[model samples]
Target: MRVGIIGFAGSGKTTIFNALAGIGGDVAPGKAGRINLREVQVPDARIDKLSLMYQPKKTIYASIQLADLPGQAPGSGGGFDANSIAKMREMDLLVIVARAFDNPYINAPIDPASEIGGMLAELLLADYTVVEKKVMRLRKEAAKGTERDLFEQLFATLEAEQWLSTLELSEQSLELLTGFRLLTLKPVLVVLNTPEDKADHDSASELIEPLSSFEAPIFALSAKLEAEIAELDPEEQLAFLAEIGIQGTARDRFIRAAYKSLDLISFFTVGEDEVRAWTVQRGANAQTSAGKIHTDLSKRFIRAEHMTCADLIELGSEAKVKEAGKFSLKGKEYITQDGDILHIRAS
Candidate 1:
């Protein structure tokens, strides 16, 4: 999955990017509208235990492709630049970094709601423009088909200053929008970048109260602190996080949030050669999940021999689980569960 990191200028989005990707840099705003892309493995403790159990030659965690785009100035009045919008359209999800940090350089007081509201307005406007133009073109063509109907519905929703994601779009309407790539239709996660000194402050609740009606999930973190922690060794990192009363790094928290927001789940395939976590949309069936691993598996799929990670850990071995009749054989239509270890039976 790919997630775009975007926020107004000086929101410390690049700092969050650096923290998540374990990279160190100046965190300066990008010129030339360049996007810094990084693919970071999603940290899974289940995969860690599996690695210890199997001692695989390669233990691969699921990954997310993060795109750190050039920051737009707050209340720029202009919509997203074409290049930036194009880059955003390719993302599976958007992470909007709202400024809640008290920066001496910034004259405005920390107001996360205003930052979030402004960014959301921009996204709505961008989607509105796209939908309006498409509606106009369809009208000109005198097209009264399902495509036109879908665009008109979207145009109306955008006109109401509401997100397309909030509308109950049908499967057909959704398929019709496959080419439009409307910004408001994508899932959004708002990240409030808090001041390092006030990382645990209660003031964040007041700042976020205005956004209580928003459907998107909101998170608070000190991007600066996370960046600093990223520079430390693993042991020191754990100790530092414990010192601050945080359970894990910002990366783990954000990844878990992303997974939940996107309705994603991970299943594993284990062996001595490789033990890898494969991500799929939640509620995806066995056949569809096999397609995540390989098309051939899906095409020739018969049944899936599967067991939960917890079951394996409890039983001590696959042999023990099978002997205990805990292993399950699921058909192609069966829904795959999270942490399932799947063995495909394919021709």
Candidate 2:
């Protein structure tokens, strides 16, 4: 799961990315294609619980890839170029950081409504350009099939200043356009880069009220404060947040929002040697998700012994779950559920 951080010029997107990345030193900008990518473990209570129960030598939580794509250069006239937009299309999710705090580069504070609207408008226009080019390349006779109809439909949506995400394409139709990565179709999380005084997430809500119309998950944070908190130890971080009257760190909530935005879920594999969480798209089948751990496991797949994590913990033991008939064998086509513990039996 990869997420790209994007915003207009002087949106403080890189600062937000550095805060979430929990890395030392600021990411130097102004270079083309210079991205700071890192894999950060997602904190999961279920994995923690299973780790204790199984006493694993090594425990691993699910991790998402976060990339700090350089923001639009100051005085670049806002919005991203084709090259920059291409980079964003590679992500499973997008974190759009909008400027809310006063900045030296920006003359005035950015209004949440205008910032979000402008950001989305750029995406819609980019996609529309792609659609138009596709149509122009097609011969008149070739522009009458289902493919042409799809392009026309997309053109209409983009022309209306609406996101393609609003349209629900069927699985087969979506697969047909696998060659094209539409910017508006990707899931998005909107982050308002606010001042330290507006660090509290709740108060930030009112700022994004106008953005409620968009499907993207919107939140606000002070990248500076989050970065400072990121530098502290876990214990000290919590204490600091409490001192400031904040509930939790932006990193945790940000991850959750990304997961929720796409309806993604996690399945676990636990043992005495290792207890690990794995991420998969919602409704992914057992066989498909097995590839997430190892491609060979998917090819040699047979059956999966599955049980819910909740069942194991509530029933007191794996033995009790089997005794209670809560444990079952699932075929390759069986849909994997969130919090499921899967043990694959490969040939």
- How many steric clashes between backbone atoms does each model show? 0, 0
Worst ten in a row by lDDT for model 2: 24-33
> What is the C-alpha lDDT profile of model 2 across 1-347, one tens digit per residue?
88998876567776777788886345444444567788888888898889889999999998989988866644345678777788888888888888778776566456656777677777788888998888766645576787888887888888888888889888877887777888888888899887888876677767667678877777888887888888898899999999999889888888888888878899999898999999999999999989999998899999999999999988878999999999999999999999999999899
Candidate 1 lDDT over 68-176, as tens digits, reads 9878866565657888888888999999998987766566666677778888998898888888988999999999978888888888988999899989999878887
Relative to the true structure, candidate 1 reaches a TM of 0.95
What lDDT score belongs to each candidate, Candidate 1 first?
0.87, 0.83
How far off is residue 269 in model 1, in Å? 0.2
User: Candidate 1 — what's its lDDT?
Assistant: 0.87
User: What residue pairs clash in candidate 1, if any at all?
Assistant: none
Query: For model 2, what is the error of residue 308's alpha carbon versus the real structure, in angstroms, after optimal superposition?
Result: 1.3
